[model samples]
Target: MRNLFFLCAFLLLAVACKSPEARRPVQRSSGSFIKESAERNKKLYKKEEAIINKIIAQNSDKDFESNPNGFWYFYNVKDTLSTVMPKYGDVVTFTYDVKNLEGTTIVSEKEIGLQQYQVDQSNQELISGIREGLKVMKEGETVTFLFPSYKAFGYYGIEEKLGANVPIQSTITLRSIESSEEN
Candidate 1:
């Protein structure tokens, strides 16, 4: 009986020490959550687009052009002669003001003050809409951009001032563009 017990103990230990097997999850995730989240975002963007379209319709006088980046803009002051636009490594100085769709000012030009940003480089934190808009602007040009919530603030918005996922309007004045080649 003692020998049998010893043998049983050794067998148990050997079995326990055998290479561990990966335990399969009882219920595998079907990725429904991700799909649902994506669907929700699609609906939200569609609704926001409709609202932006309505605003554009109301302001027929202003030429609001749709951007491929899912924002809209119209030139407040277009620079026709200057074909120069900021490219990668170029530093651009500009001032911008943020407003809601209802034309309420969230941030004034004075509050934002002067901004110096390096094009296509992560030197400064800027909204995606503004970043894309700047690439298309000529020096001394002032463009009013209408950005969707995703382009403006997305999930995280300006603290205390702008709520999450809020669409906004920003008018950027491209004061100067220092060419990288010049540097």
Candidate 2:
């Protein structure tokens, strides 16, 4: 009986010593979904850009400048003298309004009254275009910006007035910039 037990243990150890095999996935991904999504985004961006460019071309009177961040702007009140633009932690007070490409007001300045934001420091609810636009502005300067859908609202738009993936024009007036360096 002891010999039989020894034999069974040896057989079990021998069977357990077999090298493990790597697991194979039941189904492999072809990466087509990712590629297709990327292609779709590229096309959407191009379409929006074309529409913005056409608007810019039609309004040649304004000296619209293209930002590398994928937007366009023309300063309604450019402060040539003041070299001070808001820096990190500086508090800036501004008022802004949004309109469609057709120049229909979607959000009035009165609707979004005096906005006080800390430059690059606050978790304030501002869009990407407005955030970037604020960094380029000096106190007492007003600029009109043309933002693509992604920069403005992207997939989620303003509740009822604005729809998803729609470009918009916003005019911002920088009232004051309280320097953080003072404190």
Candidate achieving the largest lDDT: 2
**What is the Cα-based lDDT of residue 169 in candidate 2?**
97
lDDT of 1 by residue, 59-173 (tens): 9999989988899999999988999999998999999999998989999999999999999886588999999999989999999999999999988989999999889999999
Local distance difference test, candidate 1: 0.93
Q: Estimate each model's TM-score.
A: 0.89, 0.86
Candidate 1: regions farther than 4 A off: 1-13, 25-27
Q: In model 2, how many backbone clashes occur?
A: 0
Pick the TM-score winner.
1
Cα lDDT of model 2 by residue, 69-175, tens digit: 98999999999999999888899999999999999999999999999999888999999999999989999999999999999998899999999999999999999
Off by over 4 Å in 2: 11-25
| Pairs of residues at least 3 apart in sequence or in different chains that clash in candidate 2 | none
Relative to the unseen true structure, what is the C-alpha lDDT of residue 149 in candidate 2, on a scale of 0 to 100? Answer: 93
RMSD of 2: 2.4
